[model samples]
Each structure stands twice: as structure tokens, then as C-alpha cells.
Target: MPAAHHPDLELDDIQAGALAERPSPYVGKYLLLRITDRADGRELVRRLHRIATASRTSERTDDTTLTVAFSYHGLEALGVPQTSLDSFAPEFREGMAARAAVLGDVGESSPEHWEAPLGSTDVHVAIAALSPDAARLEAAAEQARRAHAELPGLEVVWRQDCYQLVTGRTSFGFRDGIGQPAVEGSGRPSTNPREPSLKAGEIILGYPDETGELPPMPMPEVLGRNGTYVVFRKLHTKVAAYRNYLRDRASNREDEELLGAKMVGRWQSGAPLVLAPDRDDPELGADPQRNNDFLYAEDARGFKCPVGAHARRANPRDSLYQDGSVDVRLHRMIRRGTSYGPMLPPGELEDDGEDRGIIFVFAGAHLKRQFEFVKTQWLNDGIFIGAPEERDPLVGPNDESSGFTIPQRPIRRKLQNLPPFVVTRGGEYLFAPGLNAMRWLSELDT
Candidate 1:
């Protein structure tokens, strides 16, 4: 395929789970299912196809974006060839059960420790329902349950619901869902034009990615076209403790707010520190056009936004160019996060003992390079940023020796003994295929 000649995608057939600009103030429910008999797998796929939604249209007053995806085992149950399965990404082929410890999902979240529905041979399908309206969201979820009821060998294994914070904040209180990469042909352009455009193959399969070659995909071109991989992680945040940490480190309320902003690389209002270094600029943050326009090239000294800050490490923008222009667009991911459980009441500064965190969804064609690499290299290590052995201040695993420093005049302020605020509960890797693939699954012969 020519680099300039972009493919004409059938957006109407692709699942909306990976689409950009999904409905806001949304509620999402995840479903894990089991396929009882290979003989019934074909029928099961047909029911699932009937329930899943196509990508969103150009104009819509409202939406309940319902989507359905399947694990590698789910496809195998539907008669996909072993050769095709082997063609998938290695980490995905290994499945979440084998990759949990490497991903830091241990202790309470290890495969053995997970609920029966997760990491089990019987578990197959993964479905997601997202909607701005709670009633529509609930109805879509029920529709999936009823559809499952009609299939003989299908059983609903486990379910969990996650909702957007009313303030558009994640459990960490930073404005979420910023800095997504723009794909070559996807109508949703990049938020920052200065940032390079990523090839469609970096996200959707069957297209040319950064290597100028198509990523290895499953058998049958129709099934892989417009299809992409998705990794779901349920991360539980210890909210009150995080707030307390900030409060304890700062001298006054104003200092506390600045400290939190410095750690996150953005204010609660979503204004990046790189652009508004000294204070939180609500107007600049609220302006979608300007909020994500800045990069870290000028602030390499960590004077504006610290090099190890959460947002900088997560995307980096043009920060890595000085060392010979590191092309980071290929490593991008479409990240959609929603906080679950009850919010800690305002003005309280202690552990509330409530379960709450973000439901993290990563969409891309290259799982290892985009998702796994970012977690292990960018977020977990500081070598690339000139700070060796350091990790992200907020999300990195607690070592009791970790610290954060804000570069300022005279003496830089440094805080130590930073503890991790988020813990992994459970997660899975799935394939969100095109509509044609759904039809193909339904017709696969025993």
C-alpha cells in the first residue's frame, strides 16, 4: 500500500470500542463468557454479532456504543486454525495468564488469585457497553445477557461496570483521556498537529505500520482488516492515601495543588505544566485546541514539566528528539480510562477504605511495542529521560526508595518515599474484529 494513499476503511463495520471521541460521562460494563461446546461456538458468534454495534456515525445526537470482542481461545473455540493463532503477537498468544507477573499483576491479582471467570480455559468472549445515558447502558448490558441466554453452550462468567468521573478525573484526580495519537487514515485527527501521524497499521491490522510493512495477522484477510487488539486492565487506586501524600508534602493548600500538578504533569483542570509552568490556567486547559499543543523539547531541563512526570513519560511528544529524534508515534496507544467505585468525599484526607480506580483500555495493532513496552520501559524506567533507576512518580511500583524532584530556582524541591497508588485487580487481552470477521465466525463449520 502506498504511504500517501490511505485505505478506505469500513468504519460502519469496525467495533466502536477502539474508536476515538466515544460518548462522554459514560458508563461501561465488561462481560466475560464461557463457550461450553465447540459445536455451539458458531451459534454463539452469531448471537454476539447481533448484539455488537458498528462504529459511530459522523453525526449523532446520542449514543450507547456497544461492542463485543473475543480472546484467542474464543476464536479457537470457533474453529480458527492453530497456524492463524500462532500468527498473533507472542504476548497475546501467551495469554494474560502467563504474562500477569511480568505486568506486575501479582499477589491478589495473579492468575491463580483471580476470580474463576478470569484466566480460566472456559472463559472466551469479552464484551463492552459504553453509553452517556445510564438507562441505555443498562439496557445494552441486559441485551447482551439475553442474547447469551438464547445460546445453548454460552454462559456469562463474570461482569464488572466502570463509570466516568463526573469531574472528568481519574482516581488520581488528573484530567484523563488526553494525548491520543492520530492514525494515518482515521477521521479523528491528532490533537496536536506538530506530532507526527502514525500509520494505520500501528493501530488497525492489515495496514502498514512504522516498519512500512504490515504486522503479522491471523489467517483470512477479511477477518483481520480493520481489526485491532485490545488490552483491558482493572486498576484499583488507593485514593485517600494519594491525597494525603500530597497534603503532607506541601506547606499550604496552594503548594499542595502545585505539588499534585507537578507529579501528574497537569493540573486538575487538565492544563499541562509545560504550557503554564507557574500556575493552573483553567482557560488554556479548557481550550482543547491549545491544551495539548506543547511539547517537552524546550523544557528538557525539567524546569517546566519534570522529565519523569506522569504525562511526559506516557507520551513524551518530541522530548526524545535531542538524542537523535526518537520516533515515538509508532509506540502510541488509544487509551480510554474510567474510574470505578465510589468517590472519596471532598475535604477528607485519610484512607476511605473504599475500592476505586481506573479501567484502562489500550487499543493498537502492535501489543508488545505499543502497550507492553510503554508499561515496562517508558513508565517503569527512567533511563530514557536521563534519570536512571527512577520510575513514574504516581503509578510506578513502590520501592520505598523512589522520589520526585521539581526543578526550580536556587534549590530543587525533592520528595522521597513515594508509594504506588494503583494496584492491578485483573486484566485480559482480546481481539476486536471487524463486522466481516463476526459473520465469518458465525459461519465457521465444525
Candidate 2:
């Protein structure tokens, strides 16, 4: 046991420390935020120029935290250096000092615990684009590779393209980038709030002591921080496989729109099929006030949208409310990913060849409580919440070998008869450091 900084104080110190760390050339796009000490609804935005200049060829993407999570990648061509553990020694000390100052603590804090080398599975780099042109994808892929290589000690864990031969969109299809959570007061809540208030220690470290404090470490020592768990996974979708599966089993009266509703659990318009069962409701999907307003209780047993559908499993809504109180707040994930590779070639589409998928990014306070638990217990496991079924038909993994399976059923078919359809390819876990953490690295003593 050691002296640790208060959680509130740690937040600001973490940001300042990361800013001190030089921006890596491999970093393409990033979103950084400093939480307000109070709820005045104000945010501290770090000036990009103050840290590092963007490469001339760099394409920057950022937004308010709630609209979309932060995402970063350097094109393999960027020639960024890989940062090593030795490169981050000195900055670790400064970060601890910054943390102590923010918390108003008086003592020599140690940084050894936070300065250790990140695990191999904790980082990932992926590439995706519009069409199937190897030249185009290769350029992006190379940029990511070079960026990782330049960072002396940071490891690049996994990489893959979306599965497109079967569908027109990325592996998961249904025009992803939907269902993202919106930060409080940013506007209307686009996505539910995952946690009521920010819990700094829980996010950066595995778990804090009962007193809600993190152990103190020398500004440059890497102790107490043994392992940082990261989950990396590449999901490949058979878009064509999904479409054909739907069309073949669709009743003459059920059009393609209806078929998509059943498969995706929502229409392309973002409307949940469970509410607009018989038709595609563009109005509902577009209405900020009405879009996320339905409960699975409408169909109780998942008659409107199958319990095995991706949307249903990803967010159970009222289904999980034991006392008729819908609390979907905990299951939310901040997805900070991008599309990789190119769209399928026109000829390849006809031949049922591979296309592309997405580099799915899910980060939360606790890996086991948030992302891992959701995937293993709910998404991948068939019998979630005590149901007789296996798992979400679209994203559920059948076994380690076969990947995923999409269950099929007649338009009016009972829940028991559906066959499996979707599949998984490859993936890994990664740690998205806050701006403060980045700065702390740049100033570390070699």
C-alpha cells in the first residue's frame, strides 16, 4: 500500500502529463479532452500546435468526445518512430508530480508502476477505404506499419480488412458508425451515458483501493502496474452471404427492406425493427427525440426483433430491466475505430469474393465489466439472460474454429428454427491513452 492521488486530481494531471509527451508521427487523427473540475459544462481543449505539428499528408479527424470517440492512426508511409519504454522514463516523474499537485498532496510520488512497457496485445493498427484497389489500401497499411515501427517500444498487435465479397458495406454492415453515445449537454443524447460520472482510477488502472485512490509511485518508476489488458478482435462479415441469406428465405410479401430489418434488428435508416416491425421507418430513425425510444418489452420474448439479433444483444434496452426500469447505461461502449481496406471490386462482387470489414474499437472503465463481459456473456454466448438460444446471430462466434453464425428463420417462423449466418476473422485489444499520458511519454528519461 502506498500514497495515491485523489481521483479528481488524477484526471487533470493525466492530461497534462500526456501533453508533455511529444506527438508520435504515427498518430494520424486523435481526440483529446480535459474534464472540468465542476459541471460548468466547460472543456479544456489542448492546442495541437503546442504539442506537435501534423504531417503535411496527415488527414485529421476529431469531434466533441460524445459525438464520436477519439481515433488515431498513422499511414505506414508517415515514417513515424516507435516509442520505447526507455524513451518514457523521465516524463513519468513529471506526470506523478503533476498528479500530486492537482490532488493537493505533499509527498514524493513514484511513477515506476505507470512507466512499464505496454503489452503486445494492447495496441493495434488497421486500414480501410472505399474500393478494392490494393495500391490504395497498401499505402494506408504501410503508413500504419511505419508509424508503429518508429515508436521504439509500442507494439502493433493485429491488423485486417473488412469482409466485402458477400456484402456491399464493411464486415458488420448496416452502415456502421451508428448507435454512438453522446456526451452530456453536448446536445441531445445520441447514445446512452455509460457511466453517470467519470471514475478516473477505474479507467487508467485495473481497480483502485476501497478508499478510491491509486498507489503512489516515484515519478519514473514502473511498479504496481504489472499488466494492462487489451482486447483486439477483427470481425469479418459476409455481406453478400447475409443479403442472399435474407432474400432466399424471405416470403414473397417480405421485401428486401423487411429482410434487412430482421437481420440487422434495425433498418438502414437507423430505426429499430422491433418498434417499426412491418416497415422501414425513416422518420423514426431520423427523429432525435424518437430514435432510441423503444423497449424490447414490446415483444417481450423478442418477436418483433429476435433476441439473437446484433442490436438486441448489443443493447438489450428494457429487456434487462427487472423492475420495468430500463437501465441500458452500463452496457454502452465508446467505439473509437475506423473502416479498413477497400470496397469489393465490381467483378469480385459477382464472384462472391472478399471485400472489407471494420476495425471495431470498444473502450470502457472495466474490460471485464464492460467490453469482455458483454462480448463473452452476451454477444458471443448464446444463452444470455437465461435464454434458450446461443447468441447474437450476426456477431456471435460459433466456436474458436468456425467464427460466427447467423441464425435463419421463416418470416413468421418460430424462434427455434433459424440457422446461423455471420462469422469472425481476427482481432486484439488496445489502450487509447489520454493526451496527458501521451505527454508524459514524450518527456520520459531514456
Candidate 3:
């Protein structure tokens, strides 16, 4: 039997899964799995369906919890009909390895060069866990272990622990997880009031998107409804290298910090350069609503927030409003990242041989328009803003030819031969299905 598709979807029926999930002031862990037993895989899906109530509740979940997502292959492994898998987005179907170069996953970032556990094709499931305390985290881990035990075919291959920093900043000491889009009807409050609110379909599948079109859904309607695509990239940040570059290019410690801010277009406190161009404003960064309120309308000339800055490129809010060449709303994504390694102490310019970086996760209804388009067109290219050969100062390719240019009054200053400070250790494109969809997968004919 084939699953029937529906053209429209309701909001209340959607799962409170990862797309709109908010950050919690606690520690987190991610368990990546690979399926080995075909029959047992569906049994695992059944087990997950049994706890569907406990799952997909909220991102700011209470202590001892986990959220689940599966790759296109994961569903196929569990005997999902080929038709259901075929209806998913192309990128989701092809997987991340095939699109690595377009995503700037070349060189050290390539999956072929990743650690054994990450590069393998056996990767299937992703479980995200969060807790208020370590004891609680361990208890949750035990619970997760017991749950996995329900499916003998499920194998946990890779595990990474992500913790919330006290300063609410990434390993680079800059505030992240800000400037995310607010999906309409997702129940999550908007962070930036002035930034446009995207349609529910833009972030959640089955709803009408910004273009007034509902994205394509998998068969049976139930499996595809309330689902969204996710791109999970584990980025290893070279903290000392980044700090050294800033230090060397700057005249003093203050200048170094300011230079870093210029690279990211935000102060360590989360203040946007367009608002506080000359200094760090902790007060502005503290306000969730006000911090992201400013836009690139008045700063289009690259004087305030350098058109090539990482943050500006990632989300060129008002800058493209007049251009009409690209629709920013259609490309908006829900970005959530957590640092995985130990935090390098402030003012420490030396490397401690510790593995520390961010686990970057982006969720959206349209993977190509939102995540892929942003990565290739915005983050990797400078032509949209005026600089043709320039790359993002913070995380761009930074190859020998890649450099960053800052527009100034006297004369433009260009930093040449910038080295990449971030490496894509591992990543994948996943389908985060609704709770009912989980049930559909469990009930599918085996």
C-alpha cells in the first residue's frame, strides 16, 4: 500500500521537535547511530514510537531527555517504502558527502578525511540529549542506553558531548545561537522583533512557505507532515590560531578583540557591529529582542558591519531588501550550535592541545534554499556584497588566495593569506519527522 500525500498541514499536529527548540542552561550530548539489523531496525522505530509522548516536547526540556532524527538512509534501513524516501528533498536524499565541495567541505573538512567513525556510511540515527546536571546527564545516558538496547540492530558509533558556556559564547568567545529566524506558529517566541517572521512552512514542512507554497512531503501524509530537514556539521574551531591572527594584525589587546569583532560582525557580548561599531555593548547583547533588531539597511556601503563579515553574510537581513535578486526569507535557517571541547581561557594565546569546537545544526523546511544556498552563496562567496574574491574573515575558506577586506574612510585594508580556523570534522543531512510520522514508520509493513 502507498501512503497518500496531503497538500496542506495543521500547526497543532506538528511535533515540538528540534526546529523551534530553544537553548537550555545546561549540558548536552549527541549520540550518532548506525543500523546493522534490518528487522530490528523497525523494532527500534517501534520502541521510539512508544515513547513518542516523552520525545518532541521542547528543546528547553527538563533534566534527563533526548530528541531523535534520522537520515534518509535511516528510514530506508527500517523498510520505509521507496516512494516515501524519494519524496524528500534532493539534498536530504543524496546525503552530505555528495555535496561537500559546494558546502566548502573540501580539504580538512571532507568526510573522506574525517575520523573513522564519522566518515563511515553506516551512520543512521541522531539522538540529542540535554540535562541540568552531570548526574542527571549520566542518568539520562543510562536511560538512552536502555532504550537503544530495545533494538539489537542499532549501534552507537559516535558520541559527542556539548555544553552550554556560562558566557553564552562559542569557543571563539563570541556570542552565537543569536539571530535565528522566528517560525510562525511554532510556539517559540521570536528573538528579533524587527527581523521578518518566516512562514511556518519555511521552517516546518507541510505548511505554506514564504512563497505561499507548501513544500513537498513524503507519502502517506503522516510520515512527512510536521517534518523538516537538518544539516548537522561538527566544526572544530582552531581557537589559538584565530586568536593569533587577531593578535598579530592588531596593535594592542583591545585592538585584537575589536578585530575579532569585525571578523564576526559581533562583539563577544553579542552586540552587532552595525549598532555598536566602535565598541562592545554587553547591555545590547543581553537583550534578546533588541540585540538582533538592527539591520544592514543604513550600512549597505560596508562601513558599519563590513559587507563580508561572517554574521552579515550568514543573514543579510535588510541589505538585500532593495536588491530583489535574492529572497532572504526563503533562505532563513534555524541555526543552533554548542561547543564540544573545553573552553580556552580568555587572553590565552597558546594552544593547549585540547579538542574544542562547535557542533553546528541548522534546520529548515527547504534544505537547498535555506542551508545550501546560504553556505555556498553567502558564507563562501563575496560577490553578492561587492568583494568578488573575498571570503568570510572568521570561517571562510581562508586559502592562500582567500582574504578579507575591510572598507574604511582613509583606505581599504586587506588581510591576505588568511588560514582557515574552522574544520568540518563530520556532518550529515537528516529528516526530523513529526511524532505521528514516527508512528507511521513503526507501523509500516515489514
Candidate 4:
């Protein structure tokens, strides 16, 4: 069935950066700021309100862009009324740091080991600048810098430079930014024909969600309408270790590539294993129309794309429909990822101390049901699929006891003793308010 269309959405008041699809081969940066002085902070927001573009404009242009969001503490620092603060979702108020254990951020991925100021209360506001090239990226960054140039109360606490690898792959050597859910009435087409555009409330507040009910929003109708929750995470990828593990398991070069594809459920070219089960089809991968148009209903047995693969776990599609009780749309989110740090020298199996990984950003209305549910239920546990001990093979926080199973002919092949391939550097939960909401913040008397 086609998604219910919402024609009356307030696109003009929504931040373009929140719904705009990033350009290919882009350059970007994340700036974490602390508001030491409330008055100056309001002034910063006022300037930013003028600089941030609306989604209506952002969708049409391929130029540099700026996005602004505030953490829970940020709103409190800026003097948002107590009742208004309490109106927000509890998950957002407690923040990502407090929910670390629920997110499987244990062992090396725990909050104690996270980079300073990321999970800390000091991170007030987040500014992201993205552009198609270096010059444009700098142009966007300059615009952001000018927003608070004279504000002594606001300080840039942390910054991470990010870009798309020339090959358009992450540190893990596989294509990223695939399968983003399209928001209803956003003037954007769904990448997957099998997946309908999500109801507006699934991502933006104040609209009826899949259940035909309005998702909870922050207090004050103007403050929450058209606003969305944001999830920012820094994941450090262990490239060499991933390569070494596959190398030791596979029989030959081709087998090594297949093994990696099986783990991710997609070839490095972005071709899904379910569609190109035996070999990769680069042309198919390059074509967005065909690449994501597949569903897992045909591969129920996991002979093609393993049920435990990272991509499959991230999005089960129709694979879980047999239960009839679950609606996949409720757990969907808008996921965007950009690579940071230089790509590890290709074909090198030895560990290099350089830090390289992906800066993952998620936009959704229901943080717990959409983002957190997927992380804890789908990616970290396998009970839904009948395998209780498994997690996502490629990115799961697996220890020596972790394993992945690939179902095949005579006997199923299982890879044992999987090590953790990705680690959480840090993260935060923020609220990206509508443009008018931002204006409200700037003019706040409280």
C-alpha cells in the first residue's frame, strides 16, 4: 500500500538540513559548542536563524548548508521554561550517555571511554556544515563562525572534519548512506520502491504517525511542531582487524570479498546480496532505482543475504512479516553517515594507529522506538530471528564468543570468535527544532 500523503506540512519552517539529502562526495564538519552566557547564546541563535535555510530551499539547491540543533542541557542553559523542558521525551532529557547500557555501549564502547564533551553536559549546541567541495565547505563553516564570532559566552568545544571517501565507501570499504527513509511531503522520492514514504510524524513532530496518532512533542505547540530529534554518534571503525578476520576465514581472494559481502549484506559496490547473490553487479549498485528496490521476502531462508548480516539486521524489510505483530515502519529512521579521517591504505592487514571511522547522524520523531529499538532489538540481539546469541556481524560489539551463521546447502557455515569491529567514540541526543522554533528561542524572555 502507498503511504498516506500529507499535503499541509509546514515545510518552510522546517530546517532544510534536517530533511535534505546530502550531495554525493561531500565535505562536512561537526562543531560542538558550549553556551557559557545565556544572553550571548540567544544572540548566537538569532544569527543562526537567519543563516539556516528552510527545507523548501535546501531541497532545490546543491550548495553548502548549515544545520543547528540543541541538546537537553542546551535548552536548560538557554532558559527554556521548566514546563517546556519537561514536555520533551524522557530519552532525550536523560540523553544518550545515560542510556549507554541500553544501547549496548558496554566494554570498550562505554561512556567512561567516550571522547570528552560529547556525552558531557558541556555540549550545548551542535552546528553542522556540509558542502560539495572544499571551498564551499569552508564557505558554510565561515557562515557558522560569523554567527557567534563576537559572542564570548559561546565557545567551540569540539570539531570533527568529515568527508566522503573518493571511492564513496566507509573505512570498512563498503558503500554508506544507503536506504534512508523518505519523509512524507518532503518533495523527495523514496529510494526503495518496496518501501513507501513514511508518515510525516514518523520523522517530524505534530503529524499523525503510522498508528494515526500524533507522536509526543516538546511543550508549547510552536516549539515542537515540525521539529525532530537527532542522534549524533562517532563510531571508530577497525579496518585492519576487519580485513584480517575475513582473510583468515576465506579460502581465496574472491572468497574474501564474498565473505565481507555476506557480513554486510551488500557488496562494496553497494549491490545487495539478495539481488546479486552469487557475484557483485557494480552497474546495479550504481543505479539507485534498482539497488534498493529489493525485499527479503524471497530470501526467507537466508541462503542469499544472511538473516544475521549487518544490513539485514539494520532493516529486515519484509523478512519479519510472518509474525504479523510487528510493523517495520515504526522502527525506521533517517540515517546519514559520512567518513572521517584518511582511508586506511588499501590491502594492508596490519593495524594502523590512525583513527578513522564514520560520523553517523539520525533524524526521527520517536527516538526510543525508531533509533533505540533498532539498536538494542535488531542489531544487538537476535531473538526475533530465532538466533539469540547473534548480533550484527560487521558492527556489533562482539567479543571472542560472538559468531555469525550463513545458511547454505548441505550444512550451514558458521564463523566463530568474532571480535568487535567498531567502537563508540561518543554520542549525543539533540532536538533540531523548526526554524520558527529557533526564532522563538532567540526571542525567549525566560
Candidate 5:
């Protein structure tokens, strides 16, 4: 397979493999730095100006390249007119042109517009090291933290969240990071041996319209585009709350192990419920060929996996694929998140207290089309599989009026009585830009 290339960015073997490693892409030691106020925006630009002009030019470090995906807040706070901000901020454009005269061989600039909610103004900054180095990452994070402190208008919402290939927990607690779409032309044999030649937009965005275009944007403009919409969520799972719920649901025959498997859709090992419904299939989970191959076809109608199973609703494998011909690729998202806080204490299983959960990060072309749509329409909405009483049993919101319930079916046995397991704490939306765009922003005037 050839390498997947955008006009401004490239996904080489290393990058693509890292991205395809798990359910989520590998974001490395990156921080979702947010700037909330206009005054902070001005101060930020001023410091960037000083750094750009005074700092001696040096070879790029594993930590040197900082890519950002700014929300409209950053742009509006910077006072970018709506007309020019989409194409290129006029001030940034001019600054780049002036810098080009002094800094020869500066890379070409390619800016793309992304969809935003009607009244959003928060800017998202995604800063990552070009290469992974612990010391450098610490320094970079410190620099970002200090920068935030210096600017009175900006407030750091979430801090020090790492991006991983797989999101830590399923509804069940197995190592659930495996099988993702291979970037087209990346020299990687598709995990699904049958589907060899997949298109870029299929996984990145939904299928194009009659003209083969994505909604709200031209195909050329969206295809190979650098910026992708990312939803960042802080989910706080009450370990005690979850454990007590499991214990209450477990009848005389069911054990703690069985109960945990049902809740997470897998066991401590990374097996799937569809394959090893009765027990943990460590061998199957380890096998690359068999792990991601099962579809919710038999499971779709609630025969094999439940209607609200995490993996089932997440991709649905072949369940939603019409005729096994039409690819429901748009539903896919690159989940690049990591687990935060510490493991739950042994005796605290019954305590109704605070505990941490996964920091959810999903990236795709359109928020409405991909991330939000999945959360609102399928995951949180139990109607996808025609089950009025089921939502994503694990992450589904708790509201009796809304008809969502967490069913506790032990291992292979079908039991309907269960309660909610996960709860939302806080979250936000962000955008991630390419390397060149970050440099351009630095040179711009406030």
C-alpha cells in the first residue's frame, strides 16, 4: 500500500501504525490546552511574538513541534473576522508573509474550516512532542502551564491527559484496545482481509453525497485535511458505585469475575463478549485475525451481544453495514484517550465516594456527523437496535424518564435486572491543527 498523504500533512508508517494500534489513536504526551478569554489571547500572541523574533533558530526537537486545533474562541478572541478566519486569519497570513522574508524555507500554509456549534468561543490547543522524551515533555508542559498562568484571562480546564491507542475500559474491564481501520494506501494490509481498498473519507468522515462530497464542505476541501473535530470528555466512574451495583445484581450463582465481565463486555483479558460469552478468551483476544472479525449480525437483534454492548454500539462491526456491501465507515472515530487517577482501593468498593475514570477523546471530520451523533443517536439513545429499554448500559445517561437501564447479564447467562454504571463529570470540544499552522499562529500579531 502507498502512504496516505494530504497536501499539507503525511501519515507515514510510524504515524499510521501508532494510530491504528487500538480503538483510539496514540496522541503521546500531548495536552489539551484551552484559552478562554480575549485578554489572554492577546497576551498569548505577544509572548509568541517575542519567542518567534528573539529565540534563536534551532533544529526541531522531539518536543519542538506543537500542533494546535483552536476553537472559534481563540480566533474570535484574536479578533479574526468570520470571513477571513476560515481561509486564513488576515493577520496570521500577513505575519507569515513577513516571516517568510526572514525565515527562508518556512513550510507552506494550508488552513481548513471545521464545523462548530452556533455560539462556541473556546479555543483548543493540542501540543505534542515530535518525538517522545520524558524530560522534554515535562518542560513543554511546564512552559504551557506558565504561559497560561501569565495570561489572566485564560484558565486551564483539564490538565496532563495522555492519548493512547486504546481507551482503557469497555463496559467490562478487559484490555480493550485492538483493531482499527488501516489508513488507505499506507502499505498496511487491512485487518479485514476482504475490504482491501478503503477510502480516506470513509473512516475520517461519512460517505460522500451523490456528488461524492461530505455534507457542509467540498470533497477537495475536506479530504486530506489536517484539522479534525475532537470531543474531549472527563468521565468519572464511581468504582464503589459500580461494584455495589454489580454485587446487587449478582444472584447466588454469579461470582465477582462473571459480574465484571458482563459489565465491561470483556474480562481482565482483552476478549469480546460475542466470541467468549461464557469465559475470557485470552487466546482469541491476542490473535490479530480473530479479535476484531466478529460482527453484531447475530448480536444485532440482541441474540448474541446485548443491544447496549459497548463494542456493539461503538462500531457495530457488520450489524449496521447494509447488505455487508455499504460500508458504515462514517460511524468510526479515532479514539485517542487515556485513563486518569488511580486504581480503586480494595475495601472502598462499597463507599459512595470520588474516583477517576477514562478521559474520553474522539477525533473525526464532523462533530455532528461522528462523535456527537454517536453519543446522542446511538450510544446514549437505545433505539438503534430497536430496544426501547436499553442504552449503552455502561456509559448511558441515567434518567428513568428517558428509559435507559443497565442490564446485568452474568457472563453467558441472560439476566435483565441491572442499574447504571458510568456517569459524566465534565468535558469539552477541541480542534487539532497541523504543525505548519502552529508556526503561522506564532508569527501573527494580536
Candidate 6:
């Protein structure tokens, strides 16, 4: 195998949110907007164009970034040509809500049960601002406010403020934002030495993906090049319930932590089971060079990292490649998550009734293949791993009937009567256009 030839990416025009690794200890905000007038929407785009940070830049002393995206209805509301609108990926055109069933959003997770303005047609625009501190975050927010503040035609319908928990982990107590793939031309290096750089087209449009072909882009090169689909999902975690479940299943305190690590495939300290199979290694977990460096080839039976564990099912790296029927690389997508609400007090077993979880952000070119495929085939179901009755132990919409199996020495250990630990509050699929596309949209003739 040869090293991939990196493309001359248009970093200056690409949104920083698409490629830039989020800074740790960060504060951010997510805003959902409804576009009432086409002219005002276009004006909003024009204003945001000036503030949306580019992927490659040296002007900022403070690490603050602004990103703007439009939903399918948003493009139409902004008066985008019908032909162009029809040319986008069908999954993006139909919107995430329309495909809820495929994403396992049944029962309480269904769109009808979703939060207001999230899955509705009223959600036209989605803007996100992220920074390392409160002051920088506020500065970015003000810029976004100015973009649509005076525009009576554009109304801010919903806002959710998110930040890194003091423990620098998700509400469930695992270090996250790890295992992000390196985009070939993005200049960011992969944390895992075993992982190869993904083709730029896998994330941004108009570039060759893993298939060695340019993915289908929306009509008109200017509107599609350097752009990508963004998937935003709000998940609510039942921290107290999760803690209680582990406590009930384990023999003692050490076994309780081990059970959690088995489910997540990584200890709370971020140490992977593949590397530190017997114990949690905080030192190894903190070292970026070693934490994400292992593959699942030797653990084909998943004794080290359970096949149905949340992290393993989410990536699976080389585990599925042996069968030749599946290629994990095709489904790979960049995932970024930020915790919202306050963390529950440690070791508390009772429900606090406070809202807290993670806001998941995904960036990729192929929505159906990348994001949706993983959600449907990998996490929600376990057929690919030969465990049809199982789902991801942590985030999957598990029920009393759902069970998780851990490969062990004498025999397999099955944990049954699993309860749903996470619920989908809301979600949206938006198109993040490049700077040139932003300009093209701003100059569109309604």
C-alpha cells in the first residue's frame, strides 16, 4: 500500500467546523432559526459569510469559530433553484425526521416525541459557535446574533448552550471526542497511527472518497464543491439509571468499573480495552499517541472489546474487514460531541430529573452511507457482528428484550433486561457550504 496523495484542499473557503478539531474545555451554542422571508434569509447568509471562520487561518489569537448551515427547507425558503434542491442527496433532501424509523427513533425516540422546532419544517437554519472560554464564546454568539438580530423575517426558534463538563467527559463519564478520522487534505493528523487518512471527498464534496470517485454533489459545481452534510442530534442520557444498572450487575466496586469499561470498550479515563484489557490505564489513556493506536484484528472474537460495545460497534476498525462483505472505512464519519446541562453528583443512584447528555455533530459527504448506515446497521442492530439480538450497550435504544453479550473464557456472559439509557431529544440534517458556496447562495437571484 502507498501513502495517499493529498489534494490541494480549499481550506480558506471551507468552514472550520468541518475539519478543525474542537479545542478541549470548550463552550459552545447551537441556534435553530426559521426563515420567514427569502430576502432576509439571503441577507443572513451574506452577513454570516463574513463571520464564518475558515478552516485554515492565522488571524485569531482566541480560538473562536462560527459555522452556518441550511436545512432542506432552508434552501427552499432561501429560494434556491428547485433543480439544485432536487440534486442534493435524497437523505438530506427528505430530512432526518422523515428517516427517523431507519435511525431507530421509535417509541419515545420518535420524531413526534422530539423537542419543538427541531424536526419540524420551521427549522430552516442551524448555526453553531464554539470557543475555548466564555468570553470568546460570547463574542462568537454576538456575531451570529448580528447576522439575524434585526431581520424580522428570520426568527431564532431554539437555543441550547453546551460546554465541557469539569471531568472533560460526557454525562455518562467517558472521555469523548476521540477517534476522529484525519481528512487527507485537511492538514490535521490522525491520533491513531494505524488509521489511514480518509480521502477528502469522504467529508467534503467534489473530491474522491474511499471508492476513488467523487460523490454525487448537488447541481451546479459552485453550490456543492467544498461543502458537506452536517448531522446534529441531541441525546439525553439517564446518568442515574446508567450508574444503577452497573451497580446491580457487578459483584463489587472494581467489577462495577470493569462492567462500564466493557460496555463502552474504554474506561472512564479513555483507556481502550484493546490496549489495557485487564485494567483502566489513565496514563495510557491520557497519552494521545497510544490511546487510539490499537486495532480490533486480534480481538476478532471481541474478548478484549465486546463486539456489541458502544465504541467498538461505532467504529469496529479492522474487525469487519476480514469478512470482505463490509468495509468500515466507507461508513467512517467525523463525530464531535459537547455535553449540555450539569453533571449528576458522583455515585448518586437516584434520578435527579435534570436534563443532561450530549449534542452530537457529524460531518461527512455521504449521509446514507456514512451517518445513517452506521446508525441503522451498526449501532441499533447487531447483525453484522453476528449478534442479531443485541445493540450498542451504551447509546443504543435498548429495551427489556435487548441484551448484550460479553465474550469470556468459560462461556459467553449475557446481560439481559437492558433499559434504554439514552433518548433522542431532537435532530436535524443541514448542508454546510464552503465560503464560495456561501457567496453563491448570497448572490442567488430569487
TM-score for each of the candidates: 0.94, 0.56, 0.94, 0.97, 0.69, 0.97
lDDT of 3: 0.79
Better model by TM-score, 1 or 2? 1
Regions more than 4 Å wrong, model 5 = 1-9, 12-67, 84-172, 185-198, 202-211, 214-224, 252-256, 287-289, 298-301, 322-327, 346-348, 400-418, 443-446
Q: Please tell me which predicted candidate would have the highest lDDT against the true structure.
A: 4
**Weakest ten-residue segment in model 1 by summed lDDT:** 53-62
Candidate 1: tens digits of C-alpha lDDT, residues 124-205: 8888888887888887887777777767787788888788865677777677877877777678777886877687788888
Worst 10 residues of 3 by lDDT: 1-10
TM-score pick, better of 2 and 4: 4
Clashing pairs counted in every model: 0, 90, 2, 0, 11, 0
Off by over 4 Å in 1: 1-6, 53-61, 106-116
- List model 2 lDDT by residue over 1-446, tens digit each: 34344233233322221111111111122211212121111111112212222321135332111111111121111211233322322323122223322221122112222212111212222222222344544543454344333333343333234322322234344544445554222223444333243333333442352235542321232211311223333334556555555556667635756656665688776678766877877787666466566667667666677766677778776677767433455555555334445554432324256544454555444454556556666766656555444555566543323222333345444323333343333332333344343333333332
For candidate 5, give the lDDT of residue 116. 27
Better of 2 and 5 by lDDT: 5
Cα-based lDDT for every prediction: 0.79, 0.40, 0.79, 0.91, 0.49, 0.89
lDDT, candidate 4, 203-262, per-residue tens: 999888888888998979889988999999999999999999999999999999999999
lDDT of 6 by residue, 1-446 (tens): 21122366788878888898777889999999999988999999998887774323657756678888999999999989999999999989898899998899988889999999888899999999999999989988988998898899999999999998545698899999778899998888889989999989899988889999789998788899889999999999999999999999999999999999999999999999999999999998878888999999999998899988999999999988886988899999999989999899888899988999999999999999999999989999989989888998888989879999999999988999899999999999999998889988989996
What is the lDDT for 112 in model 4? 98
| Candidate 6: clashing pairs of residues | none
Which stretches of candidate 3 lie above 4 Å from their native place? 1-13, 55-65
- RMSD per candidate (Å) reads 2.4, 13.5, 2.8, 2.5, 10.7, 2.5
Better model by lDDT: candidate 5 vs candidate 6 = 6
